[model samples]
Target: MKSRSLQPQLANLPNYKVRESHKAKHVNLKISPHHGLEVVVPKGFDHRRIPEILQKKQKWIDKIARQFEAQQEFLTPTAADQGVTEIVLQAIAETWRVEYVPTSNPHVVVTEKPGQQLQVRGAITHTDLCHKALCKWLAHKARTHLVPWLRTVSHEVQLPFEQASVRGQKTRWASCSQNKMISLNYKLLFLPPEVVCYVFVHELCHTIHMNHSAAFWQLVGEKDPNYEQLDAELHNIWRYVPVWVEH
Candidate 1:
């Protein structure tokens, strides 16, 4: 969908872009370091009321803007600086140095070389293409390691799941569906091994309990005695994830 830019009527208010989403049921505001302010409204919503909404939420916007500004340097590097040089997968205790090689091929291809190195071949000058190649490789690695690990945990807990898949989800680390299909975010490779195991247990338990009720917690606790502490660690672990993965 195309997003329309709106100039702030009040000089003190920050500028925001207005976007229409078919899935949206009501107007929502999003503030991120990468995109700044965004006003998302449902389709056919009146655009004229945006300015008034912004005025009412002026203080909240200013507060969130300042918070993002404070964490700007820690969030992600600029686009020009996103040329990934090294990747550290704490979950598996592996580190890799990335090397970009230019070639005449039409597309980029990522290959693993000896000595813990990743070689990005083909039109390496195209930044976005390189990112896609890296993400694809990450997903492959996640599946190679995570799927077996999930199965091991399932067998240990005697909880059988129907299926497991991996993706580069932005906000969540993992999810379990009603039918026992679990989707794990490849980003979990950046987290600690114990926390990653907790995530596996978290989703596996969902095979029995669909909600986060006390019963679910009891089951998770039975599997991982320190579930509370491990779960808390996941809240702030996103800082360790490389910014290039998100781009």
Candidate 2:
């Protein structure tokens, strides 16, 4: 077993990835419905034994992978799947109307208008193009909405950072650098307000303490008492993201 401390370590396997969490008190293997196999361990865990452990759990991993594959097959939509004409920005509590217009050239142009309407001009026949336009618009919405929200939270909590940015990350909701710069996943716009606030406070605490030490979590708890619940809720929020904008 590794020494108990802070900071998680990532180990990529042949088929999946393992994230060793410092807070983990035991050797635990999790098979995510979205991600594949993840191995969590207490800090100071034996790094060389991961392969052996995975080999021991191969059958379980295979079973879980099959289950996830079946679920994804059902959840994944076709390109022509019901065009997403309306969406709700849960983080900001705003309902948006999405309008799609077809164009001749293979290009997508998105314009944000008044009255919570987004105009997507592109090759509607090309669902890929339409999806692209919608994705671009989502990013724009995050930049316009999330970045400013972070600034406001920083001010409210009196925890200032150098700057903030939004990106389309596949595996992370948000991150903070040693230089005090924070990067937020644009998909956070899909999460509820409380969960979004928890994420912001989590990263903001990172600016002061880079690791999830006792002191760090103490600060987070002080800010948001329900952070534990909110953090747990984040694990399943991907299902709420509009399918077209997820890519």
lDDT of 2 by residue, 1-247 (tens): 2222212332322245556665456677655454445567777777667767676766666665565566575356663266778878899888889888777767878787899998877677767777777777778889999999999899888899998888887667899998999998888888888789889999999889887778998999988898888876765566666666654
The regions of model 2 sitting more than 4 angstroms off are: 1-15, 19-34, 38-48, 51-74, 79-81
Give all TM-scores, in the order shown.
Answer: 0.73, 0.75
User: Alpha-carbon error at 112 in model 1, in Å?
Assistant: 0.6
Distance (Å) between predicted and true CA of 141, model 1? Answer: 0.3
Q: How well does model 2 score by local distance difference test?
A: 0.74
Worst 10 residues of 1 by lDDT: 1-10
